[model samples]
Target: MTAHYTSQTDTDRAATETATAPAQRDRQARGIGSIDRLAGRRILVTGGAGFIGSNFARWLAPHAHVTILDDFRSGSRDNINDIDDISVIDGDIRDAGLVANAVRDQDVVVHMAAMAGVQRTLDNPVDTLEVNVEGTRTVLEAAVEASVDRVLFTSTSEMYGDLFEPPYREDGPIAPKTNYAVAKAVNERYVKSYCEAAGIPYTILRYFNVYGPNQDGSTDGYVVPKFVRRALADDSIPVYGSGEQTRDFTYIDDALDATIRSLGPAGRNETFNVGTGYECSIRRLAEFAADVVGRGHIIHTEDPRPYRVERRCADITKARGVLGYAPRTPLPDGIAKVAAAMKRSDRQRAREV
Candidate 1:
């Protein structure tokens, strides 16, 4: 992961050029013409250096003036180093003064900075609560003070917990079993309450297992990337318990499309489930990952967590009807993309070394 730093003046100038540049041709080529509505808008993306956040920021950068606020805790500089003309604020979201400064003059705030990962949150529950809940509160307060046009809060489908059946809906009851889910669930309520009281429009997006390029495949990363990493190495892919636990694995592009649509008027002040209405078992996913990479074998392991959701899928009827949110990528195709991206990244790293 290479790192590059530029002065604020340079960043601001580049941003101005990017905002003023015509992007219709490029947008059409990238298939992101839907987000052209955001052209010339000023947007702030907290945790814009993380996986989903960084991808969203990169997609939005070509169309809008983007500012990223991250403390570099879980987010890496490598994830965002190549993005041109992005203003980055290196600070904690819990810092009220810093958050206020970041939020000022931004047309929209996409709050994505939070302590993520199920195991990590379980190990450090207090820090997770403070960062995810309190940090969100600080961002909301700042957004209200700055009079931003909208606040988009990113929530997790894990909040649905084991109590819910498959095909979870936005209006369905949430029974969060993990501390990470609890923090996100609480933040969702905070976003709604704070935005309503302040008369600020808000959009809540509950994302399922979002995965693709730029995702972490380290010891504490998501299942898809982790599986890909091991498969590439011809190592055994671990499956917890009976491997029957299912998840709605939404690819990054589809997730981004849903997110961009949420910023428009059609998605105003509403919660939407951002996922493909399909369920894939963990065992099947592991097999697909190995097959995509052309290597590796599957191995079963004891479920470490005290509780686990057996099946989870999204009911995207609302998102589809309201925002025209349609997921175009299939699981096999998405996994192939991830494998290809990892190979390219490996080649780049080898050259760097």
Candidate 2:
């Protein structure tokens, strides 16, 4: 397999350091600069071409040596094309030889690869299970054999389902209602067992509705991006069921910061809920998107899914106390940012055409 490698110049490094000096100082003052601990490490990010994974890899490229292993099934090359310092390995995580090669000599492995989307998983249950469960097993086993310092696995809050109340805590019970959630929950168990048996350090991050720029806005995409896309096009925004179902919409930056902090000492062998503690109903989310774009009208649509979670709000108290995780962006602000980004992307595409 052919691999693409890029390197950052001294001038680029200097410029980045100068621009981020103030923010770095602020983080240090707040005792949350644990993310600085990852500097100079060799890190392998599985699925590094996807939305969250690509963003994380891009942000960390200047600070560390980053390698991305992705099959490009659900990931796009455009996501990582702009970054000039990361190494890209085009392959699948399920390929043991490929995974072993990627994991070798890496100090950290951030496993964010998985078959995502609720409707997509429902439509292809068997493929979802095998890719998520088996792919995760392959990555974790490779990490163990490679003797990587730490392995961080990204999970979803959907595993909590609708059984319990809102503001789900980390230690609470998980009642996964979807095929994708079931696979993620099972992968969590596998990560715990495999890491523990091999005496490896691991961290499991259960992310809520993480959305921002670079997010997929297709039909099978997340709510925020989909709503933004429709609003930008002046199309009617769809609200499922009574639109009363609530979710904790965490911004992309906040989620990335939390994940970075988890690589520090406080997050070893721990599970943390990465989300804002606030909840916003689906109706309100649609309204926010419309208001942000200054277009589109809200329209109620029937949700055909049999299993749906009525409420999802993460109790991020554990994350705060443990990782000093503080989410700064509110829902409206985040929606505005997404709208602005989509408009910019539209303009870019128009110019290209």
Candidate 3:
């Protein structure tokens, strides 16, 4: 990964270009190559300090003027503090005033702020729905008001809801079992309606199981991070149910690549499933994590979470054809990187102690 070093001069130039006529900028973008489509555009990323959001913001900051609007609820300031040439706003998405202000003069908006996590939703279904649904509406309204060039909404494959189908397609049956999935489904509909009525270009991406560094297993309640952390500690890796549940895990880099590609003209007003068309059972996933971490044990138990998905795999033909997305990292390779990161963190903590 080549580091992107931004200076004050570049920041000043980007700001000047952003303040120029939006019409001219749009024309240039339309005429330019896809690789340079994002250059110097002002972009607002909701929940920009969270796990995937932070990574996307960092990756785009060098090419675009990135402004992050986050409530700091599940996101932390530390995520974006080291990245240069990025603006950070501390506010919630539900606050219409804050969202509107953040949307001002931005060429694009990427809405990722929502109440996520299945177990967390099961614990507080009402709150999850209220926050995720209401927050998305707020962002959509603000985008309409600002008349941003494009808006990207992140949905989840969990919206498919344990359909026992292999390689779920973009037009599969809707069976959202959890409040989190329900909220995402509702938000997807809302985005379509608003974008169609208001004449705003939009793209909806249903991300499959996403895992990488920055995912906090302890607090974020994600399976990969939790299992990896436990494995690194030489603790028993817990498996819910018979450990037969399966998911299509897309590494963060591949996910981010698809996201950036979708920002161009090719993805407008389209819904695509972004994932590797591969399935790994929970038992296998845990075993891989343990193997990567060098030493650990697996323990099976009754399912603790409500409404688990038994099988999941995405048919990425659309993503491949439309966005030119190709997932590169294999499961073991990704797991090895995660384990290496955990080991580094562990060593750092020990030294601090």
State every prediction's TM-score relative to the real structure: 0.91, 0.91, 0.89
The local distance difference test score of each candidate is: 0.86, 0.86, 0.82
Total clashes in model 1, counting residue pairs 3 or more apart in sequence or in different chains: 0
Would you list the rank order by lDDT, best first? Answer: 2, 1, 3
* lDDT of residue 128 for candidate 1: 95
Worst 10 residues of 3 by lDDT: 1-10
Q: What pairs collide in candidate 3?
A: none
- Inter-residue clash pairs, candidate 1: none
Candidate 1 structure quality by residue, lDDT tens digits, 116-149: 9878888898999999999999999999999899
